[model samples]
Target chain A: MAQQHLEPTDPTAGAPPKLSTAVEQGGPPTGDALAGYLRAQATEFLRALRLHRETGTASSVEESVDAARALRRSARRISGSLHTFRPLLDADWSEEMRPELAWLSGTLGLEHACEARLDRLLLALHRLSGSTPFPAQSLTSDSAGSGPPAPVTPERGNLTVGAAKAGALLERQLTLARTRAHSTALQALGSSRFHAVADKVAVLASEVPLTPAAPTTDLRALAAAAEDRLLAAAAALPLVTAGHPYNAEALVHGLSPDPAPHPQDGPWHQVRLLLRLHRYAREVLYGGGAPVDVRLLAAGQALNRHRDASEAAAAAASAARTPRIAPATAYALGVLHADQRHEVEAARFAFQQAWQKQTVGTP
Target chain B: MAQQHLEPTDPTAGAPPKLSTAVEQGGPPTGDALAGYLRAQATEFLRALRLHRETGTASSVEESVDAARALRRSARRISGSLHTFRPLLDADWSEEMRPELAWLSGTLGLEHACEARLDRLLLALHRLSGSTPFPAQSLTSDSAGSGPPAPVTPERGNLTVGAAKAGALLERQLTLARTRAHSTALQALGSSRFHAVADKVAVLASEVPLTPAAPTTDLRALAAAAEDRLLAAAAALPLVTAGHPYNAEALVHGLSPDPAPHPQDGPWHQVRLLLRLHRYAREVLYGGGAPVDVRLLAAGQALNRHRDASEAAAAAASAARTPRIAPATAYALGVLHADQRHEVEAARFAFQQAWQKQTVGTP
Candidate 1:
């Protein structure tokens, strides 16, 4: 199919409805306006997806990371905009496109994570293995439920042995994983599933399906509902509860049996995504004129920290559990895991602090 | 109170109850054995904690990361063992120590994550800004939901300008956050909350509370129940269901809304914690005898990927929204966000594949 281009029209260009359009003969031309915005996003998404495919084969890490990042951002925008503007678009088309976009972006996201992790673990190893006075007093002072603190000698040789082993174990495993992820990403890019999405997007760049009755769609109401849905979800999180420690166990046990831990258990994680969508919807509507909600932004940022810290801790724990590693390496990894866990606590603390400080209301 | 040391006796040295023990003159010596094990873990935790304290003031990132990791691992072991053997120990004591251990580990976890993130975003900037062919065709071929792919020229100037801006924004914000976290951690270490726990642990090194009825505590039953609880929790995960993608939205929306999304919302995140507890239980019971469950291990690893990818995507998105940055930087951040989100997608895909391939049973 011949690829067509949509003009990069401003998404917020259409004037706000003069009144509740329910009384209008057929409502204002908001459907076309929404479609115009959707098309612009679709166009940008296709452009970035194309960039990803082109650079997917590159051997250079930098090239792949950049390209993948572009593709992911575009996919999110398209998906978020589709959901936000779904009322004005063909229901079938929106449903079909959302999952496919999700699939494509997810593929790229994994590859990027592998690359970043490899980078992080390796750098940690380098720093760890470097000659520095091993802080002998650290373990003793910070020791918790163990026996009395072991004496730390100011010897680099003793400390480096364990740290190096841990580093080596992590490097081997992460490198292997990164290679696998890189290959998977390449294969997915070449797959028919990907190609099919590309074809659809290329078509969407020019032609967007609009319901005949869409002009009458109340965007303000839709926006309000979306915001309300997000707020409702966020409010429902265990983090919003009094006396909660923002840990997994507390959240899980807090639920009533049945579906207790699966769906409701993830309020902290789920809220971030909702916040993303919420922020995007506001951006689409408010454009440059309105200031973004500080609370929403802060909550998202704090949650982002929470997620990052927790994931890092998990990763560190995984490394520490590597079977049959040298004792020294095991020791090093133990330290790494504890450090990452501390970060998780800090992030949670930060989130709690923010939540407590903020007035309970919409941003 | 003067600190005392519990003898590190074999936890299993005390025989399993010779009889139902209800009629025994005095309960068997099981409480002492259990306390012995608890003391061992406590000692290890304190040792690591000391190492962390000693190294906390180190300017070397590597030293701090390593020390923090050790503190975290020891804390986890202590926390896990405490829960596993809570029936044999003082309930109030165990309850109090678990949260405090959690706090200490959490503090270190946050510090490590901030340091890691700052390192990652800065490195990404450096690479993105470096001169290369730019792998310009990436988006064109991968373009999915938009219009015709934009052409990429090999020109380095256009891409680098925007990338550098994005990189700068991330560097500045992440550095600030890292600095703040470091200070917070330091403050926490010196706070009464931390010192109080330390003093308690120091005292516990020598003495432990045993419930009067503890001698007859059935450990084997406790282990079985703990395992069952973990299995039940794991089974509750949406991943256990066939054809579930690992996205937060799908999982949330999958629920019919009666039970809501709380239970199903957190499989990818919540399951990891349960798995950690289960693994620890096994390690405690089996020691070096039984091999780790390969399926459980693999699931844990896959879930780790899902988490890392998703978190990275969120971080990227946050970066993309950097306020008052140059347009070029914003463009770069857009690419980075897209890339991270794609990684998230890829990890979820990998997880679904793994879950499907595994036999339907507790790993």
Candidate 2:
């Protein structure tokens, strides 16, 4: 069978020695190997969870953020692996763990997401407003000066008038949102639900429940299936739109007043989800000690940027809709919104380039 | 008739005294009034043409740009008026003058367009690249320093690497295009064809070639027809798409390798053309000395920005396609292209706002 080609003939040469030993002595690359991989991930998640709790108020903010990030990363890997390798594990146990893991990841991630978005938007606003010297003041002063009057382009002058005000409004709104998210994250971390999840992860660190059929199941085929799903999801994205450096039509969808997630973002997010599963499945196949795939890392970073930029644009759009704002303020928000959307396009372009490079290099 | 309502009941009150005198004494507001209007426009064109020639090398670059702009403006008004009120003018003469006038306007405007695009793109690049402090140097120095290390976001660090190089490439390409356009304008000005057009305008300053039926044609009905066309075209625009602060789909059309004008831009250019005709036709209706309509002027300014930004984005996309440049440079160009599209969206938003205000105020 084609799947047999993926099996390691010299077992130690492919998977880590521990997993190879488990496969050889345990009779097959089945639930035994899968459980070993799951146990290792669970142990790592427990370590991160402990580090997160131990950091407490004594640690610097950066250290706390780092701990939370580490905790979330482990949770994501565990959850994603469970999802992709479900057939090899106890279905009810794995299914029950997935949502708890997801909740923990999402709860821990909100503050960081908010902070990154604010940073992205503030940077964009500074860049956009910085170049256009407010011409109103310059024009008036030029009229009063003894030197030959400078030529003022009326169009550039008018567009930049509200940039400062717009920046202030955005800073205020995003900062407030970030504070709220921070509190929410803190609350969630201390909740009984978080404790329950931590308790389950502690148990998982010692024991992994697996199905009886898992011992004979072909791990390679399942990993391949995970990769296939990721590829299919990616292929379905509006890559043609993403390939364009400027996507004006994408911006139109962003302008809608509905507060729900943007429809255009759904497919990209799905691809991101699938990509994580594929990455984690590969981790299991390699027995969790494989050298990093630089191309996959780059693609992940690009997708993360795509997500950040998309959210930031939506935030800017929401801020622009504030009641009774000055026209200049609204105009500035509009410009800022466009700037974030450009970042979205830029991120998508970066992803396309990185992905294309990977395909060319690998194939 | 519905057309009669557009006609002046008290001619002396609606039109300038000179046109009313021509209408009253010459029997009907026919070829005589139309010819008088044409003759006045021709006189302005002749004056502008003379000033353009007289300014020569002694003029400041600003003065030269101003003179060229003046010459183009008069040429556009004359050509547009000829198009709108064709029935009142000699068909053969009008048809021949129109293209020559268009040629003069386009040739003279090329250098200005290039310069404006360069200014726009350079400003955008400067803004985009200015915010993120170069992390590479900071990162190394931080490791050496005793102070706590700053958190460096990986995504922002990677995307900005090629910005300066991209800016330099754009500057070189646009500057070269501008120099070529400047020389082209100079060559066109000195050509025999320009002299022929100038001589024709000199003749037109004294007498306009009127069709035999011009004497009885209703000027009001013709101007109204021009307005109708403008209104219909405006109504046909995808205002909902334009209304959005960000339009991603619009950006897709921009990314096509085909160098022809973007399909999305065609409708906008058509509207701009019709707007000019309507504006000039109104100028004729008011006998040329009417106060400027602020709303029309605002809408025109917005459309001009829309055109400028759309073209600048195209220029950036073209620059990005230059062979085998660094990935960083391509990324920077992509960001720049997206920035210009944002500017395009902003301009569309501005037009929507101005046009909406006009409708509300007038109604």
Candidate 3:
């Protein structure tokens, strides 16, 4: 049955396509196009799941990582598309499948997130403490003749006594966490719950249950609404503070002892969610084959950085809370936390630049 | 006349060596010990000043930079010692010489400070944006066979589009400022005021004018008072906040738009000044020939870093205020600002660690 649906000349393709065409041109609607979009995404997800399972033991670590990443991406797109275009899909099936897909995507993503966060913090520690020559000599006319200008070695930083200890502490804590996360992810992949999700996706690859009202729904309008939601959330962000080189208030707020997520981060996270839905809606409207929009890609990338930095800061903060640690270690962790927060601000600034430059409907 | 004082067995050394010995011992009054200490510091200053002048054009940039550093160090030591030991010296002479030494030190140090600051900010930007692999793979037993685990390439940071531009802006501004400082230092060195200061230092190399009460003054009590001042200032600092991994209040306080120096910073700065005086008093008590105290040196270095980080943060904030700049650039500068502020906190943490470990009068 899946092979039959995969054929180019399937009977469902004969219906007047409403979702994939311009909204202004009115035509007789059918559920075929929406079903086709969902089926294609589901098929890709199933393929990725198969590859991920295959690579678990047989392939190099990079290949395995890639497979997991692909699976997560496909799952996210399927889940997000279902969310933004929910009215046209069968209410119970779509609602049930959405959370499963979300769980799968999030579980699969934890290892990568942990790895990326550790990379960010260690790199920051090295740069902060390492001996790098000043690059400012380029401004001097005599710089060319002087070989390379001598490094401006400040009297005291030649040996940041705490840096090595701090790095070790961070490595020990984060590596332990990553190992635990890795095992959890592996267990999840081999579990009955995962098999159940895979089984559903396989069924979805050939059949998409749709509401009776699906045939008449205007997907363009729903997609436009997703874009509008993203825009509104972004507009509400503290853009002025983001533009300012230093947002002391945000920094102070981040320092609160409360273990909950930062309040200021909520709006940006909301924008990131809305953006994914908007991007996935576009994919559905274009029958999942349109050339990727460069601006949307840039904006999406920026938001992704925002999320990574926010998570990394949280990790640093957690590491700092380790009891009875050396004051030097705590100090290094503090610096690391601040570094990631700065990165958060930078990512927001990048998003503002990319999002503002975007023209609606151009893609 | 200066040659007589340069001799080891000069008339001043023949008196009961009161100031240079343990403060608990009672001894007959004499101004010779204090006079000898001042002359030795002055002689070193003169030598450094001469080296700085000679190295201005004939030496490599490194030599020139080193000469300036040496000159500034000597000038600072002399100026600080004079301030702390004011009662033993001719009031008029000490008062007049202190400001001249400060001016010379400030002018000479400006270029290097700018270079170090630029280095700090640029390094921070690169670390925040650069692609480095995750260091967490060490935790896994299988990591050795993976030919170095692949960099946990987070989807969006591969191209931090703003980093390059932000680095360029910082370089341009800081390099220009350094050049201006270099020229200003050179001009000041050649000015009549500097020449007058130099002539006075040269005369000081031969003779130090002493007050009538110098012979009776207890140098030990005065030096102890300087140490007391340093300890008092340190006690007033927010050590608890410094020890915490995240100092949100300090970070927020730093973000005030007011151009005045941060209020929290003022106490640290005061402590730095007191630390210097305390250190120089020890130098005087030892007749400037004692082995360096490792703990005191460590504490001093930490305070120096505190000063540098505070100034670097200020510079980043100033650059962010550049009118009509791109939001991305401002964001980068903002990140740089936060990075430096974290450094300031880290320095304070280091200072607390080092200072708390000191046993008074042990050195």
Candidate 4:
């Protein structure tokens, strides 16, 4: 019952459990255990925020408004919390996180407003049904199809003889939403964690009409495949001998990207937070007046990359089993050049560990 | 069960029930029946827009974000639906019933945000209580007493992860709320809603002391007394001669002395809507970053005015019982003066209605 302070000597003191082990075995990121914790927490916050907007039991007129504020506020907190990693970010990367997150929060506000309206309509239907001396569906159908344009009329409910209200130009708001899209897309370009995935997914997200292409699959499966690939890539990144994602800060700072958020040090934790924001904003604008199936598009692209990775993983697995292509053979043949030359000891160790696991179950 | 259409022959027909009838009857407002029906439906659309914030929830992270967006879309639609009142506002006021309401939908949006935030916090509290290895009271205590420092260590439950967000300005927001306060002095100087009744309520409200002069009776009883007074004033407004709450719009529109919601024409719906908004905004801003006790404030204010108005109403009632104060008592003396004022017939009718209602029972 005590408010225990787990500042240092905690399970998360050094690094997160799964990721730390993955890195120790030489197949995933290591060292920034604190960063990982921060990232995970950010993700968790975003997830919990959804409950407010997603739960049912039709919100009251007052609640609808409150719900929208809650969504915006939680998002702001999550995005702000991401800023804690500024010292950890290399350079320009940390600077771009806030604006993107802010934009994302703004988009969330819009989205919350939408769902609340639908719920309100449902409530209205319930009320109208009760007041009318008729079945609910009859009144609904009558309102929707047969009677005057009910949606456009204002004096139709009890307890709502509200004063006149001004109407905003939807097209203006829509345009504003669209203008922000490119900013999100550009942010994805510099992100090693999500860009690679988003890029590959974007390809698959498109139409395959009468043209010769792989037959389209249902979204649910596509989404699952995409997730599988992303996680796999994440697991494999530390093992890859490229050492590329590490130098991300150098290239970004040298280039002095136009969308820089912080000038000196920051925008660290913001990178991942902003990506989520990018995802959030894109979804809101697309769902509005525009009919864009962004989710499927991302899924398709992920599937393609997933297929490629699976093939490589399979080949590597088969070769590992052949005595002729074992480590001794690879060392003699000099095919382990990457391990020796690029200092890919961690990755090599990972493969050896996998083989050991295959022979003797993990301790 | 049939969806009724407007009877073509009766499009502009039907003896419109008085305004108070709408409140008493509770189905829809009585008016140009068609206009009233349409306006009420539009109001539903607006109310629903605010509720969509609930859809922001999804079991998964992305799903939740998507849900949030869905809610915002609903809000936008709800706001857009108010445009139908534009033409109505432009209609001739030769047959104007009361002050036209304005800026109501925007007010609703503001209210929706407040409600969403409160509910989100409440839900988080619920989740924290339900989620763990210990007593809820401890968490509640910690939740209140812990210091994360402004904008730095924002915690949601026991999980405190620094995200570097930019929402440190909640206190600043609270200050902004103060700026929007509908101070009694301002209302008294400008609005003509119920100055005489409000004058009495003002004495009571002021007694709470910007600095607390002294302790008083129970807040609940005080609030009740205030509410009763407002109810009486609400009843008397229509009947009291020379009561110009109806035509004070000229000043609100820069033509007269009062600051009503502008114009003595069209629909008076937005007026009540905006009044509710002022109440809501005040509630959220002043009531401890929450909306607690706002309704009580309104009720108390109403009760105070109700008490002030009842004195006149009682005298009127006594005259009817005794059949004495014909054209001589303060009752008839005021009535004679009222008979020569603007809207004499309307005032007389309202008085008779109030008298008839009092005969049966006081509101």
CAPRI-style docking class of model 4 based on DockQ: incorrect
| lDDT of residue A219 for candidate 3 | 64
Residue-level lDDT tens digits of model 2 in B235-256: 7888877765445434443322
The runs of at least 3 residues in candidate 4 whose Cα sits more than 4 Å from the true structure, single-residue gaps closed, are: A1-3, A7-33, A39-78, A84-88, A101-109, A121-363, B1-304, B307-363
Error of 3 at B255 (Å): 22
Whole-structure CA lDDT of model 2: 0.66
| Residue runs of model 2 more than 4 Å from their true location after superposition | A1-197, A200-363, B1-29, B131-161, B289-291, B357-363
Deviation from native of the Cα of residue A314 in model 4, angstroms = 57
Q: Which of the two, 2 or 3, has more lDDT?
A: 2
- Which pairs of residues collide in candidate 3? A245-B334
Sort the candidates on TM-score, descending order. 2, 3, 1, 4
lDDT of 3 by residue, B107-185 (tens): 9889998999888776666555433322222322121121222233312221132244456666778899999999999
Query: What's the residue-level lDDT of B242 in candidate 4?
Result: 21
Give lDDT tens digits, candidate 4, residues A121-178. 2332223122332122322111011222223222122001100000011122233444
Q: What is candidate 1's CA lDDT for residue B107? A: 80
Q: What is the DockQ of candidate 4?
A: 0.01
For each candidate in the order shown, give its overall lDDT on alpha carbons: 0.53, 0.66, 0.65, 0.27
Q: Candidate 1 residues A1-363, lDDT tens each?
A: 000101113324353332112222223225554555556666776766666667666556677677677777767877887897787788998999999989888877876676566555445444434334233323221111122222433232333444444555566666677788778877888899988887888887788787887765645566566777777876675553422331322211110112112232256677678778876665454431224447656777877865654555445445543433333343345334333433344455455556556553322
Best by lDDT: 2
